[model samples]
Target: MSGKPKLYYFYGRGSMESIRWLLAAAGVEFEEEILETREQYEELLRDGALMFQQVPMVEIDGMKLSQTKAILQYIAAKYNLYGKDLKERALIDMYVGGTTDLMEIIMSYPFIQPEQKEGHLNTILLKAKNRYFPVYEKILRDHGEKYLVGNRFTWADVQLLEAILMVEEKCADILTNFPLLKVFQTRISDIPRIKAFLQPGSQRKPVPDEKYVQTVRTVLQMY
Candidate 1:
């Protein structure tokens, strides 16, 4: 309905990166609208214009979609990123769900108090190291695939990379323990379209803000 598909979100990656990456990988032409402030966000939330009480809204092909996973899946389906078959789809779902778990922990950092933030972040990292990271590590190690689910690239790889980069950016040595997983990260990140989406002049921030950097520092135990 609109002149071109448009993605709406804050400046940071937040929950929008996967969708943005998907669009780029699929070579979809789209416009991006960045909501500049909390007040503006609150207004949108209060006005009931948002189907869900959140950002990362996407308008495309005469439909507006909310919820990150739903949007990712829709884009994946449209672009054939969900994997090649039912079995691959199941595997992708498993990784996507796990990545969502990891995201929940990282997303909590901004709301954490400054004094307690470091400890909270460290706890979340430990949670990842114990609960989340190894699952994917084993997948990459055992499956021996450059991508996550199938022989080809998929949305699962996109989701997994977004999650892994959450930790890798902060702790330079975190991925050292999981060599295959590290390679997987590089392989997906190197995808030409996703690579371009992450280039310096891209609309997204090149790095997380200081608050999130504090979380990364805590996860890496650098502070």
Candidate 2:
């Protein structure tokens, strides 16, 4: 809260969206530095804060932080959103890892060549439901809780919600076969601050690109 928290990322919703989500969830105030061109991003590399030469970097409390997940956990720990106990924190990490795996696929769609982008998007949609969503669905079923870990909201829920939103963007009806996930997604969407961040006119892309996504109304049909 001392120095203005600064975030660096390209415009639109990319890897940095989740970082924004965590900040909003924590009710923290931060400044944004949108990297608009390759030159700008390259220039940022000169600072050495971005060790990986990637974005979604942030600076807070006089420390330059890179790596999306690490920054997210840092904010979570700062806001007491990490979790209540040791085991819950571990489970939170597990779900966040799974969510990241699925998000990586959805995020790759735009960079793909036009001819291959459709197939890439379809694969992402399939993998999101087939390979990842079920784990959380089962966790929700077994735990009978509104949030992903423990009985309260945690950084894991924010991560999972972002993943689901990312996949839903690619496949609008992808969750039809997974009602539990749909509910889980809704629960997070209604969070007051998150709701405001997601309102109409927001910069978030509804999909990676309209041309690449296919309308998969039923998840079972992914096979």
Candidate 3:
């Protein structure tokens, strides 16, 4: 109980996961305000002066902040998690920028029609994956190491892992064909901090006992 700030997180378990994972990796302490119902969320919206209009808002000493990447930037800056050199920090920013595009695609999948699934949704992912894989491979190849950017873990590493996991979880078929992508995913997961974070309870909520994700898998299987 170090009296760290409180973070108000919503239930979707999307972009918020990256912020949570980065905090965990930094060993930061924060209270979680999980709003489970619309009534609760409405209450938050009305009764609070600085409350977030969206989920995944973090409050440091009662000051509210929103936007997942901005929260990561603030935490990374405060916790000294960015990097030592300017160029390295720039690289981390580059990776985070790339990850934002990946997140957009993931969020768009649910809106895609059945007929458009393979053509519209999967096609974008396939292209994005192909484009990003070599960049990651070059990083791993050039650094002669794991972890993106620097000697220590940064937000870039977390963002990269989250992007890779989203693809695997949502569209493993697209990933499996790319051996380098699979290897990159495996390599990132092997990081000790990341490996621990990927364990069962690390998810924002308890995943259903059954394979709820199977529905998405089945739909993808149809293509």
The top-ranked prediction according to TM-score is 2
Question: Residues 48-129, candidate 3, lDDT per residue (tens digit)?
Answer: 6334466667777546787777788888887788988799889889988887787667656655666876776666677566
Candidate achieving higher lDDT, 1 or 3: 1
For all predictions, the C-alpha RMSD in Å is 5.6, 7.2, 6.0
Query: What's the candidate order when arranged by decreasing lDDT?
Result: 2, 1, 3
Higher-TM-score candidate of 1 and 2: 2
Ten contiguous residues with the weakest lDDT in model 2 = 214-223
Question: Clashing residue pairs in candidate 2, if any?
Answer: none
**Which residue runs of candidate 1 sit more than 4 Å off their true CA positions?**
1-3, 37-48, 206-223
Worst 10 residues of 1 by lDDT: 214-223
Residue 137 alpha-carbon offset, candidate 2, angstroms: 0.9
Instruction: Output the worst ten-in-a-row residue range by lDDT, candidate 3.
Output: 207-216
Better model by lDDT: candidate 1 vs candidate 2: 2
Global lDDT of each model? Answer: 0.75, 0.77, 0.67
lDDT, model 1:
0.75
